[model samples]
Target chain A: MNEKTVAVLKQAFKEFYFKNAEKIITPIRMKEREFGYMSFDKVMVRHLSFQTEGDLRAFLIKEMPHSVYYSCAYYYEPTFAMDEKGWKGADLIFDIDADDIPTRCKEEHDHWICKDCNFMDKGKRPDKCPKCEGMRIDEKNWVCPLCLKATKDEAIKLMDFLLKDFGITKENIEVYFSGGRGYHVTVERSALEELDQLARSEISDYVSGIGLNLESLGISKRASYEKMQRMLPLANDSGWRGRIAKFFSEMEFECYNSNDVKDKMIYIYRKMKHKNFENFVGEVIGKLSTKIDAMVTTDIHRIFRLPNTLHGSTGMLKRRCDDLLSFDPFIDAVALGEEPMQIFVDHSPKFTLMGKIFGPYKSERVKLPLMAAVYLIGKGLAEVD
Target chain B: MGIEFGLEDLAKYPFMKEAGDYVKKLSLRVEDLGQEDYRPAVERAKQRVMEAIQKNYISIEISEPIVELLSFPLALMLVKAMNVEYIIHRYSLAEAIRAESLLKEEKKSIISYIFKSTFNLEPISVKHELFDLKIKLIEYLKRATHFHEPEWKLINRVVDNGFVYLKTHELVRLIREEIRRTIYDRMKGVSLPSMPKNLKEAVHEISRVLPPRSDKFQRVTPDKFPPCIIYTLDLIKKGQNLSHYGRFLLTTYLLSIGKSVDDIIDIYPRSPDFNERMTRYQVEHIAGMRGGRRRYKVPSCRTLATHGLCFKDKILCAKIRSPFQFGKKPLFKKKSTGQIRE
Candidate 1:
């Protein structure tokens, strides 16, 4: 971003923080959490400890950083260096980002440009550039309603795993719209806080269905068709067995004791266009498993974006969702003002903000609401006019 | 209500808190254990360590409760005094196994008492068709994390209302794991005063019979290892936690390069959660000596990248497709030097 765009974003962020300083919810054990922020220039300032919510609010009002973060982990001395800080424990957190989730809308909004050859293309970014075979590929990702809805669905699936499978109560689970293209589900002050990296990895694997063995669920490739039908897990069984069984039932194959029904189900499974039992199992796993960022959940020392702060990328508030089913990020997470502002748009796809649709403009100067202008500028698609 | 356990229970589970209370009531010091009155205890302690090392199981004989109870601590001291890592792990496992076998015959009340006193877990008894006991989910996870089987994953089990339902045998198995950890912790890092003459001789005798550490990996070239293997080895050497895939990569890479199972097992002692039996089973399974009887091949660089274990070198890694090809000389290289020329 240029200096002019940075100044505008800084001013808007400053206004938001100043007006809403008191609205920031204090994290549990605030004094034990490390605070950090990134300046508009992208210089990260970390190892900062605040004694109270008032101190944190005062710092925010003075600095008004582009983005703010607090550690998921609690520490004996929050300001100490990484290795020196005595780690108490961390809240179990899961991140479901639109970037990680594969959505059909990405082909319309996401594009990648190879830095080596300057070759640009739409759709998912290739592992390496086709023209130059270079690894430096810059991707431009825009979150559409479809992408956001996909991410929200993933977050809901993750919440299901946390609640029914892990047995975490609804009151202990807090879901938040991450203010930019994702959702964060945090389990706070629970018995899971003391889990180490390996344990947390196992939990991640369970939710994501990594390393799931078919034999454990009584679905074996080598079993005879009769035995396989007989050994199929019932829909009321526990855990993955029940999940897979329910998935099959939803596909119109009920696990009843009738010979005709069993024969029909086996016949359908066998005639799945050369997809063997393994492929069928794989399909079930893919559809039933929750897509979670395993790396973020397993990292105990990671710092998360603070709630109620403006995301630097979109200028949206990272606010909690009291009712996830009805929560709309574009409508509810908009914290910036509607004052008219003029900006020169280089190129941007059509998007919605605060329930109003804004254009797919080429190189043109247009007057827009403050929220839309700040969002476009923050995304590096616009500059101050 | 506090359940009362008798001398038989204390002698069988000498690591229990009640055993400590019994020993405290007797008020026997280190010096007194060396005296003639405690000769049988000293002898039994030597036998305990010897059985653990040579046979991998310590037999319980509660004919003499005092001797049995006293021998437990004496054996711990002897293992600590020897201060050998292999012996420490073996002895802890043997003692835990001994406790597990004895707990199998005890009633529910006794088993629950041991659970409460030793592991600080209060698993409530649940009347269910498949499961008889249910533990708090957190308590279950803390113990179950050590298990590598898919069945032990929390998602595979029956969990309801923050309690994990478990079979009696499964509960016993979890207790055995905790007992092993507790025994290992108790045996580690304690300096004992000079032992009695006979006890010192026993330690010396046991040391003579201890198996020599495997040195087969000395023939393998460490300098030629790929970056990912080198990184995993570094983590293992530093006693850090390695991911499952990281362990698999290191094991398969070593096995592919003709490292013996014993040599591979020796490499893992520095890991924080090393279990000799588990390591040996997994290593042998990979070597095609167990389960499925198909020797696994080293994963390709693409597979490594998918699992996020690839730590590729820009120049060297780009040349090889698989980690097995990492250190080998190029096929077209001349026989004189046998090295890839820049």
Candidate 2:
């Protein structure tokens, strides 16, 4: 009823509850890395359709072959509604064979990926049921660069940075397991109306922008068809999130960025402090949405010059924003490479006038939601603790 | 006056931003664009003179200084053939530049009409040929630019008319020769010395090697939604990378040829190995190459497997391949650069 955005989460969920009150809606958290392979050693393919029944069936058959479960995919807004084009989502990924996709992978395999020296081959895989000659083999387990356990610590630290930076508090933040392999940290839409699209994206960019020697966060420009398959929703990942945690645990949080947070925030003792982002974020609250394009541009005019933003159109081509339609944030997740890939959507997840979290895309075409980003940061934080 | 647009204005275009710091890019293509900046000024001058109904601006007439002056025919030609927005692309400009170069360098008249015409800019023989081409080009632009969002289909009309204009004089022969040379020069830069002796032979070689021209490519054009494979094919032969450029080229090419990767792989058995290896490079280098060339610089085992060059440092190479992870590779202490090209 008002001009400002109000997350009728209570209302929306209540309505969802009324429609499917007999059903369940679990907040799923996930943090995955693109393994870069499809079912049976081929590229993965995810089907996208304008028809609800057809696409849902296809996705169920392919991605959830062992299980018949589906997450809330990008069904609303710009991505799903655009020109109705179908794509074979594949991302050529190099899987980190570090810890069998998990830190707690007790069944036995390798674990650990190094973020500092770009060291992927870490930990020991026992041969013949014991530690194999792994201590010497330094760089082999690289299947899941994005969610490898070691880097999650760095990933989560950035989230903490954003929380304090954006003036977001725990009461305002909600975390969930992505039902598969990641964490989803959600800040109520009502709480975040203060941040503009660019500000929100900068937060995304910073978490992802943090570079680890082994592999950087987000999608690669040269992602291949086969690579897209691993990220495709059609090819399911059963244990990817665990692999991400293992990687995070292995890497001791090393402060590489001059402004990056180096430790965890403990809410129990009120010993919560994110070293880097508090200042800038505190200054930006309340004045965000009202800032206007001119003001935002003036504030972060340097954004137009960042290497990624500069040649953006040619790198990641998407529809020109000419309407109010939003790209269901889930669409980007569905299009991901089984990891936290940054994405951008011109409008909000619901095609709301206020554009929200749309980033960490697996490819230039994919646009992940803030929900996935939240999980990634949450998992990243949990790893630190 | 300074060109109204700054060099940075190139950034606003889709491809230029990736082209990177405009002043430093080393390509004839960039130079050609620079020359194009002269067009708007030239257009304003022409329009002002037309409105004045005046004989000259400073010392030059609205349409004179060429050996022969046929204002009516020239204006009519412009209205007929070209689209102002699409313009005579660089290839055509190259044609125009080359032609002008010939007249001055050869010490001979380009066409007989220029010597006997009403006024003079240069003592060239082929003033009529230049005038006719310019007129036709401008007229074509008038129609093309008039419709802000004209269908790409109109390109066919322009090309059809353009072809007709090309046939009017000896210009056709010169263009063919220039096109042949341009094609040859590009290939010569890449194709091994053993490949071809001259331009004609080179064209024949590439035409023969690639899949045959189907009706789709022969007739398909920009007007069509899915453009012909020829445009992309042209980009590759012009020197885009085999991974980035090659993928886009192969996708459209296979689509046009109606062939699948499987079909091509069958023909080239080593394709899978090559694809994985090459794609690894594409992904690894993607970070360095995001801007364009930077996206293609990723080091790979492909350098050793396909080429004799061994990429030093196994850890570094693995890190590079991190962007292209697809399961895990068996770790062997990465060996030194080995000559593995088969």
Candidate 3:
């Protein structure tokens, strides 16, 4: 980590424990932190012993890397007077406090990351590097974005990587941004209670078993789903108003069924103050295809009503079939790419809106044709035959 | 949406079909009135027409054929009401008779001289063109009639059809015109001027046949009568409103605003109200007068004039002319050197 990053971590821990640990001590012999040994190549650790926490802290700074460390919570147990084993099962527990060790252990060698796909290399963000002529370095996951070459996917997994892999229990899994370029998944302080003490090592092992690769997180499912959008048809006898009410509540309106739809629509349109209704409401409804899986009523009137058309006012009741294509809902999913998207479900119009002007039998009363045109236009769907 | 609902609802009304059938029958009768018959017709023709109009809009109106047959009577009434024979003769001759002596006037703008020269000799009742206009007006009125009786029934049937219906204004016009013609003829043969001074005296002998109301108006002033109603009637002939009610309203308004009743009676003027109903209508609307004037309900005279008049219908009210457009004309002045100036 850079100096500022180190300062942040130092301040976070020191602010809480600074007053309590004035004369903290460690065992005179180099105390064993953990007995398990790694049989793999390239494993080394620096060790030192101290009488005071200050001395140990100095030693940690002098030896450890600036970033990248893991903590294992384990301690020796004590027993109460057994016959032969004495204090084995019956021994008082003794724990070595890890407060003195820095979070990172610095490596002696320099690190490099790929310029394109994050293939990391050691010995400086290299010039004309072997894997990639595009110069860059990585101390973590190494995939070269500039060159086709890639390192083993298991280059280096941060605590965040582990969290993502195991999908932290809902309580601990708050998503946030890392300082730059990627997201940080913080297993919250509350997670301390949720982690199973007996299977602490198993939890870490389970995270590794997820088979996450650094190079080719091949074809993210989110990306491909955008390519398959469709128009959501109007559903009959559906309780969609409740859903719309919830959205209004989210927007902080506390709207009710009695509230005038036209008034609300007029308010929204005025707030947007955009010359083009298409661009304005498109923003709010566009994100909603996935989350709510339906468009809001506020979207329809403020935009697609198109009152100033050449003919005259057109009204819609239960969605009109002819209106489908004009409102081309099946555009790119969330507009991230060229993948189409549609409302997973359709919504209907309120009946009170259309008037009861009597006309020539069914010809006048049942103006379904107008309704179809209205729906298609409102949704921005491509007109269909 | 336009007429479908209206048509259906009308069709279902109990008497509508009967009314429609009767209207059609009455229309046939009116057409037959003129052809192959002179005087004899189904008895109570006017009553039949009224009932037919009550049932349906088309049958009540005088058919075109009926108007042709009845033209002489209609035309006679119109000429008498207008007093056009004397007026036209004087007006036409006054311009071209520059010689001051009748025989010495030279023929200038020959048609004008012919009119000026022949005007006195031409029988007031027999001018073919004027008679033709009268006949045309009668035909127009006939077109407005219903196939059945009563004006309303006629309106119900032929509202948007291509028939040329008369407005209240036009009805008012026809009334005045008919009165003018009738008065003109009544004066003929019954009385003669024998060199009466002031055209009014010459016309007076003829105007005696006028309706009592018209006569009362003519007596309002020595030389002036209420020309307002008469003038309004003249206006509606060429420029008319859509309904007869509108015509009545406008003419009454003109009478209220224009000449005195004595002035109108001094001319050929009459109405049933004229002989016995000449009561004064007084109003006080000044603020703080008569016990603090709390009676805000009392409308202005102009507004009061609107009440009980034929044009009470809002749609008909559209024809009511602004008071400003109905005021008197400026009298022509004679310039020096014996020349008439406008």
Instruction: Point to the candidate with the largest lDDT.
Output: 1
State the lDDT of candidate 3 residue by residue for B224-284, as single tens digits. Answer: 3223333445444444332334333433442443444323222222222222111111111
Ranking by lDDT: 1, 2, 3
- Best of the candidates, DockQ: 1
Pitting candidate 1 against candidate 2, the one with the higher TM-score is: 1
Which docking category, incorrect, acceptable, medium or high, applies to candidate 1?
acceptable
lDDT of 1 by residue, B255-313 (tens): 98778886688789889888866787688888887546788888999999999888999
Evaluated with TM-score, which candidate comes out highest?
1
Ranking by TM-score: 1, 2, 3
TM-score between model 2 and native: 0.24
Q: How many residue pairs clash (N, CA or C atoms closer than 3 angstroms) in each of the candidate models, in the order given?
A: 0, 103, 114
Which portions of model 2 miss their true places by more than 4 Å? A1-23, A26-174, A179-182, A186-204, A208-385, B1-342
**Each candidate's interface RMSD, rounded to one decimal?**
2.2, 25.0, 43.3
Put down candidate 2 lDDT per residue, B1-342, tens digits, no spaces. Answer: 122333322211101222233323433231232244433433432242232222111112222321112221122122122222111122223333433333233223322222112112122222331123322222233222222121211221212211212212433233333332332233223222221123223233323433232344344333332222333344444554344444533343343334433233322223423442234333323433211334232223353335322323444344434212212344555777878868
Candidate number with the higher DockQ (1 or 2): 1
